[model samples]
Target: MFTDEVVDSVSIQSLWRKSQQSSQESRGCQTRVVHSAEAEAQTVSATISCTQTEPQYQATQQLFPNHDELEPPGLKDFLQRVEDTVIRELVKNAKSHAFDGFQVNWEDHSQLVSCLHCLQHPSAHERGLHVTSVSWSCTGSVIVCAYGRIDDGDWSTEGSCVCTWNLDRRALNPKQADLVIDVPTAVTALCCHPKQPALIAGGLYSGEVVIWDTSRTQDPVLVQTGMSVDSHREPVYQVAWVPMQKKGEFGVLSASSGGRVLIWTVDSDQGRLVLNSAYALVRQQVPHSSSSSFKVSLRIRENTVTNQSTLSEMYFRLKTMLVHVLSLSLSLSGEVQIFDLGRRSLRPAATIEQGDQGQAATCLAFNCQNPHLLAVGKTDGTVGVWQLSTDLTEQSPRESAQLEQIANQVAE
Candidate 1:
């Protein structure tokens, strides 16, 4: 793994793999041809050849010649390499100094984006209640804000609220808000629907998930309070919308601090949200090694992060067939676990570590354009970019046929 610093942006280019190697024999020729279907298009053909020959050695009288070696690097080549190294260091330092002094120059035709408005409650503007979470609509025209406070004990909803602001307006208008929800519980997490811009999902400190429709802001459209032990045991740390497998049907996935992942389906006809299923994450144990005759006990190290709490955040990669979750622990160590959501159980398929001894991750984001790339932000103001590659086995023709038949039957 290569660890490179990224101060501005990072990107990966397309990778190409060669299917065949060049021939070992000398003086070889190869030909390749391309076929075109359209009459207007051109058909091309090419030929390539390789030639190798041994050099004939001859004795020659040298007149004060000091360079006659071909094995090691010569003096001139060594000096040139040293000079290139010095030049590289100089360029790196110069760029670092320029950025540090805020001397960056931008093109005249470039556009700059700045904040145009700010929103805050009039009565609580000065003593500002802590903003716990925020979310953006699918169209990027509205902002949803949630309020809460940090407490040693369980949180209460004395002055908590959920509000939305119109981004197209120039100023914050009290009457311009399309939705303002007053709840008796503190809102901890918020997520917007992928297809519906007006639909919103909020997770509360009371372990309840509620869905609100902006068209009718009087109250929540659907509330799953889990009044009869059907909800999460702990606070819901994160919530995300899952892409529906079937048309016109959608679901919401929530992650809690109790190592539970719950899937809730939306029922528009009944105006209700119901829990479809729940998955539990279990701690994995290392197996003992066995020899020819007896078994040997190998000492294994314990993970401090796994012993403290469960998942902190969740991201679902629709194309990769994987679910990524960040762990919440007492220590500063950050850990991410990947699970195959296609399986019945929730055992982690892989685990990745982040941060140093005292640093922790603050946020994480996956590249939608490139499913194999992930970006993580640390508490120390550093970012880590990683590229992931998965090993998938190919199935035989008979197995593939059987799977296709099963899928066809299910569709029928």
Candidate 2:
């Protein structure tokens, strides 16, 4: 046998060379076995080298830089790199389908208005009034329908029309409304026809529905009233115009305080317009056990002539659904129900119970491009979005399979 010191020195050098060779062959392969005899020889060599001179292990460590110390960076450099990574991630997220947010730029402030407060006419009510419902005329003029208590201890009359500065004119032409329509009771809901210009339909506190012709200055040409012997028992809460088909019959849809949805057909018989109640789409009880007395309070009070709230509500709700009226949505008890016009049935589309449940849904709107994208406003001044995608059915399986394969590969 060789001297112990010489044997140990040779073994250490052999072990280092073998390690380098194995690394060079396959850096990623972690399972290559080392011969036990070779390892023993290398250990013996290391022991002999240590005995013969100042420990070679210490010298080797000094020769090879410590990875952690060599790669240390200053605070500024580290922060800059982090910021760059964050910016890149943000850009990628914005381009991805997962990101949803509003992006718009307005140059002129006057072009928009908030409907937070309903402007007051001094002679109409002693305390003026707050707008209960509002609708936009065909010419882009605002039709503020106000309802509030007058000084006379009686609920003031309903269906008052106040025209603000015409937005189409692009100037502040604000003026007190000279035109007003006194209905049987306070108007609870308002809707404009999709095809007919200057035509408005409203549901009233007296459980009646009325249509107004803005072209005529006098009282609304009551096309059909719902207070008849066979009218909806409960007060009407919401009204919507059916999306006019590109080439088909035109109609209107109305939702009642009693959870009844009705569809009507408008026909012209020898220059005389006849509104016919055609179908009762849905007539289910409100799902929530809360008092049916729940109503959405308009943020606009009389004497506060701002259109911001109204415009924003309209922009998010009405404008979103202008593309396809096939479905109608309302949030009840934090659950969104979509009414299919074709099926005439209610379908629970989505549920958003993450936020305050007590926050009643004030308004709901749909995206123009995507019918499944809905924007909902709550009574607590919060807006939430729900995105529905049919693509999920196709992509989910493939994504799950891909993830499983990645995990399996990592395990092996």
**Cα RMSD, each candidate:** 36.1, 34.8
TM-scores for every candidate against the unseen true structure: 0.44, 0.38
- lDDT (0-100) at residue 110 of candidate 1? 15
Give the per-residue lDDT of model 2 (tens digit) for 262-298. Answer: 5555544432223333223222322344432322222
For model 1, residues 1-412, the per-residue Cα lDDT tens digits are 8898869788975443222333344687777886668556677999999997554332222443445655465877788879989999998897784333232223221111111333454433343444555666776666676665543365564656777776556664743344667767777778877778888888878888888888774666565545435578777877888876798777887777776667788766776667765655543421234321221222221221223333232223221222222221222465444443222235443444554555544444443434444444333333344445432122344446656774585455
Consecutive 10-residue window with the lowest summed lDDT within model 2:
311-320
Candidate 2 clash figure, as a count: 17
Task: Kindly report which residue stretches of model 1 are placed more than 4 angstroms away from their true locations once superposed.
Answer: 1-113, 123-128, 151-159, 174-178, 268-270, 283-412
Window of ten residues with lowest summed lDDT in model 1: 107-116
